[model samples]
Target: MKSKIFCDNTAALMAAVREGAEGATIEIAAGVFELEATLELKARMTLKGAGIGKTILTHVAGWKPSTKSLPDPEMRLDGLDTDAYLIRLKRDTAGITISDMTLLGPQLHGAIFAWFPTSLHLHHLRIKETLWSGLRTFGMQKAKIHDCEFVDAGGRWDSGQPGVKGGITGGGIFAIWMSDCEIYDNRFVRTRTGPAQEFYGIKVRQGTRCRVHHNTIETNFSMEFPFENDEDNEIDHNVCHGTISIPKYAGGVVPKSGRTFHIHHNWMKDSYALEFVRNGVEIDHNLFDFDVKQDHGNLISAFGNVAAKGPASFHNNLVSNPGRGVIWINEVFNNLEIRNNHIVTRTTTTPRTEGLFGFNPGSDFTSIAIKDNLVECQGLARPLLRAPESYAAIVENNKLTNVSDAKKLTNAKANRPVGLENPLAFRCGAHEEFTVSGWKVRPTKK
Candidate 1:
């Protein structure tokens, strides 16, 4: 293995890059640099900062955004294009590990990203003031983001265009967009937008087989963190916190499975809106805490729905002092299984801890089973009624405890009757089974 190569400026770095072969480890010393265009790395390169603590790269204040500047909708650029960066790659830059640097994205233009790239590894870095996304990955595989921090991103939140999408500019509205990639061990705070608007911390879309673990995704003003429309992804051991700010919308985790999404062993706390639509949801060994009751419009909740149906499998989870229950399948669906969960709801949250009154499954769901769980009904229980679509909901052999209010139990509001007369004691403080940030995002070896 070779020792190292040093570069003073981006031009020198590009010169070394052009002269080097595959698998080059370029050690960049701590310095300020300029970037006018996208640096394409065709080979596997490890661009290491002298030290993550000492290395620094700053860019020009970039393009300012608005309809006036970008007359063309085809413009990829978004806000003040502080897109000039320390280093960014385009085209087949695989096996690349970028470590230890404070790379700045500050421009008076649109999105700081003048170029879009695919397949890269970013480790131990800090990015501030990205006009669009902090990191833009088109469609990459086997890439990882580790030990990074994004502070006060998604700059300059105006009333975006009428149909302007999320994670567009300045505000880090969009960070890390890709497929089959892993985003773990990162921090996003004060990554905000305008008054009633917070932006998305991490967005997963058009991606598969991706895992998001051990990240503190919080403190934005416009939208939800981990905004997921992506399919067949695993979101485990993540802390989803803070006031989810969207103007006319509510934010929540939707099980996009059919398209395929599996949610297991994750903590959902201080959340605004979470929904499930058109998917098979496997919710197991997770904790749901809906602490702040600031009213996300309709009702402050851990889980709420617009189109709620689950080919939904919910088991082995715990909900304590939240604003709602675990299952709120408001629409119709097949195979709704509820098992082995500790559900606790205050009287101020909903009517009962477990019931079929508010959100029910579709009539076509014939397989609805509730077994081996401790359920507390502060107000009413057994308001479950079956839909006319054709279904069955059976409750058997479980501990239904602390349900003393007799006026809350009525007959069949939405599903079949299985009201338990003999119940057991319920516990409130049950967490999950696995450790946090279980996957490694950065590999030390080349």
Candidate 2:
């Protein structure tokens, strides 16, 4: 393996990159390297550093040079004309690996920007304090980003930058038009000290065959799938401490109609665990603990004309302490299934609110099934499922506890008092199961 060493100069580092072979590895020594301009990378090489905090790369102060001076410039750099990035991977570059480095961006842009790379890997990196996203990739294939930390990204509050007008920007990681990417075992935390914006921990648009799993995401908006037109993408086994949003039409871009999105085996501690606007989505085997005191604490909120596109299913989930309801169905649908789930709510001092499940008025349905579920609430004063008189649902084999109203329970196959002694226990993967009684549901079915 051919190698070159650079101490603290980015210009020399670029020169070394230009002289290195295709499979060479550039070892950056421990020091702070202030970049006067973006280091354009067009070769299939490895940029390795001593360690995360030991080797830091930062942008120059108030210096925004033209991309023409870079090694391989593209017209898309016009979007970043006024801003500067620490590293830019050319579209022609492939098999590039960046590991064990700290990247700080003060230009209100991204730390690393890549376009159409065939292969890329980023591991063991600490990317922080970016004005916009920490890592932005467009049209990349076969990418792996793991064991990295993205902190204090989307620094709009501190940078005084106006909110993004049209496109989705300012996040920990933003990938547009990507394919076959794996982002796992990473940490995304927004530590900005100010009002939050419509940013996300990770945002993917028009992506295909991506896997975002085992990530610990903590931000204002944890994840967003704005108009994903792809198929067979998986978002599983993630610990999200904020809302997972699928924002409505913003800036003339509506959620694209898609198929086969598997969202399962996740732990969410937010008001809205999964808020989606499109159809053809499956949400299962997740634990939602709504710790936020919001008026509309819903486990799943499906909006738009979802029934027109394709079938959607929500099953085998556990919801605990939902402030408002369990599922808020806004639009009419042809096929919708909510089965084999558990919802538990405790008595609250606030006035008893609406039912546990609310379906909007005038919403027509062709085929809807709600079965084999359990609702255990202590202090709710309304019916468990509220629907219009015209809307007829096939409800069966559900157990209710401490609910007085029987208007919606007329179709229940069986009603029995919830046993408090056995309680509920849940475990994901190979971990030990933890038990919680008196209102918490188990991860799996009884």
Candidate 3:
């Protein structure tokens, strides 16, 4: 049934909800409510902000709780208490829908970090202008964010000191911090922090499969972030603006343990900010923008992002005015197939050693293949810009405009990287294994 709770008191509204029955609607009146802490969500309840734009839940920014000091790959930013995630729903809080409310995350870790399962829907809402991140998710499945706006404030990660880890991690409006999310038809705009912390429209960690489609990711000075350890993800049909990174962030689309990626129909803009990456991805129908030089993060210097991590494949993509025709592996990867791709190089003519960075792995990229791909460069360019010193694989049959741009890179004084040992292809908990008939990543230990 329908219910209206008018009054600017959030505590009173929460008390009302605690006193009310399950599946009741809590229609907050149009006004501003100052929240001191997180307003935890109830089971099966719908929190509809009064008329979308009229009601605002302004939070008083405060100190964040620390999660980890070392910044491991798998830890969720929950403990950080960085920013106040406006609302959170956890454990068996099924069938919840939040609509038309502008949820603002204070300058903490993230605006929203949820661990809810069993069908959650976020519709027609706008989450923007936060500090750490706009929206983040973990261990949530069947969740949907649509007709929403994740406008970036451009909070870049803490990088570029004598000892910084390459920009900062948070900021940006919508970061699906963990895994198993679906965001579609959303509008990401403004993106204030050009090439700072935000770096992505939506990103995921490991052990999740997300479908990001029909959305607009526009950035003025941010890099589309890294999707590390995530698997079975699909990014498609999104109209992107400004400058965005290619492939699926950092981890590529091949989940931490699975094998496959579906990335297509994405239009990207190019930036010359310079960054580093070590991802091995296969993209299709994606449009990459052009820049004076494409090495934004200095992956060449760090030598972590240039490893060859493919024997995989992605085909039929469009590259318009892209910097380089083909950038070979800089890291170590095994098995790859790169074909049927079109490339138009050189939008900017500030000529240097630019146009597609080729392989430069220090060691351990085994079994790879490349064939039937179109390659074009504006000036005298070489296909093999840089080859690694010790790769277990080889490169061949790729089209090229110039051959001398071909080069190799290998430095003995780089950080020797590490990866998870014997990662899982899929995993499950007790209830999830019980619910879906006979799909098991592992049997119950108990």
Candidate 4:
């Protein structure tokens, strides 16, 4: 197949592909091409642009259908009948690359909707302002999304309520049923923020051997892994400024049982950091930095099957300036190991309220271990670790300062310096060379 180049007409670009220009390099020159229909790729090819923000592709105006009879259908961003996606990679297509382009979906439903691709690579692309989602893929074997930016992706849905559970769905990148995929060195910024169904920076569900690392997700709401039985997934070295939740019912299914997930070496600051409501998860060597705000607070919150029989470990983490508490061990499951963590409270003279750790009601700590932790507070007067009488298992070597006596707690130590520095100074985002574990990271150019 011969390579073709299109400068202005997007219809000619699609026409070239339809006329058996498969397995070829289709270069789009530096200009704004308004798409009239969804560009479909059926064969293995490369869709390259001049550069990011240099070659622009956008939707045609009046693309959204109008319904005058259905009582203000203009306000409905969801369920709009549009057969338009900026790029559609059809099923069973292998070895496709879409790189170095700015896809602006103003009236389109989604930017890229790909399914069942054998191999897909999205590199150095800026996909923004998408109405539904930036990039959505399903049933892929090998996929690599690196050095890309997904900004302001999802749109708002009106469920009649204004501030409460507004029906907002879709955002950033959502990959499901993927195997051996690497989503790294990407930036998801300013995504839609509302209810849980509204927006997400990056969401991977029911994936196997997927590694999502070294990505910067700064948005109203961060990441989610909802469904269960996702085996051997690693989320590491990412910096998230918002909430990273594993909700109780993601995709309407309880992920009570699954393979273990290793979450480590990440920086979660500002909002609620890690909210895990499932088992088979390990969180370690992460920095949870929260500068006490009344609206947005809390560090680590875990609530799930209190009777599950597996062990989950939270170790070697640094928690600083906690607004609500350091850890909210809501419901006690079997065998939770909290060890080697350093918790330091902010210096405040406002009467020293709020417990360092809050144990919610109906929590049974029969087989939980809290050991070798260092807690330093400035004005907290409450008990450092607040829990029930049954929560008395292996609490030892915890050095405390400016906290009340460890009467109910056992094996306590004292007089330890709060020598932990700010962990946010370390860079957790993407780098030029991908030197992490799992997959070998490489840039697009080289």
What would the per-residue lDDT of candidate 2 be over residues 80-171, giving only the tens digit for each residue? 54336788886668999999989987554668888888779999999987655788777889999888998876534232346623233467
Q: Count the backbone clashes (under 3 Å) in each candidate.
A: 47, 0, 64, 2
Off by over 4 Å in 2: 1-8, 64-78, 155-169, 196-198, 247-259, 292-296, 303-307, 348-352, 362-366, 414-446
Measured on C-alpha atoms, candidate 2 has an lDDT of: 0.67
lDDT of 1 at 161: 60
Error of 2 at 444 (Å): 19
**The candidate that achieves the highest TM-score relative to the unseen native structure:** 2
Q: Which parts of model 1 are misplaced by more than 4 Å? A: 1-4, 9-22, 34-38, 62-86, 108-119, 155-177, 191-193, 219-231, 242-259, 292-309, 347-357, 360-362, 377-392, 401-446
**Is candidate 3 or 4 superior in TM-score?**
4
Give lDDT tens digits, candidate 4, residues 362-417.
Answer: 44566667777777776555566665553465677777676675666775654542
Alpha-carbon local distance difference test for all models: 0.49, 0.67, 0.51, 0.67
Model 3 lDDT tens row, 1-446: 65545445778766755565567677888777666666666667787887557777657655443333312132455344523566766555778787877766444445565664557888877776665566655556678778877665324534435554433544343343335667777776763444444445654444346777776666543334444554566766565544333333333544455443455555444533222232444465554444455524221112345343443554555454444334434455445555556555553454444435454554444444444555676564543344534333443445555545334322122232211112212212112121111111234344
lDDT for each residue of candidate 1 in 385-432, tens digit (9 for 90 to 100): 223332245545445555443233321233322322222222111122
- On a 0 to 100 scale, what is the lDDT of residue 100 in model 3? 74
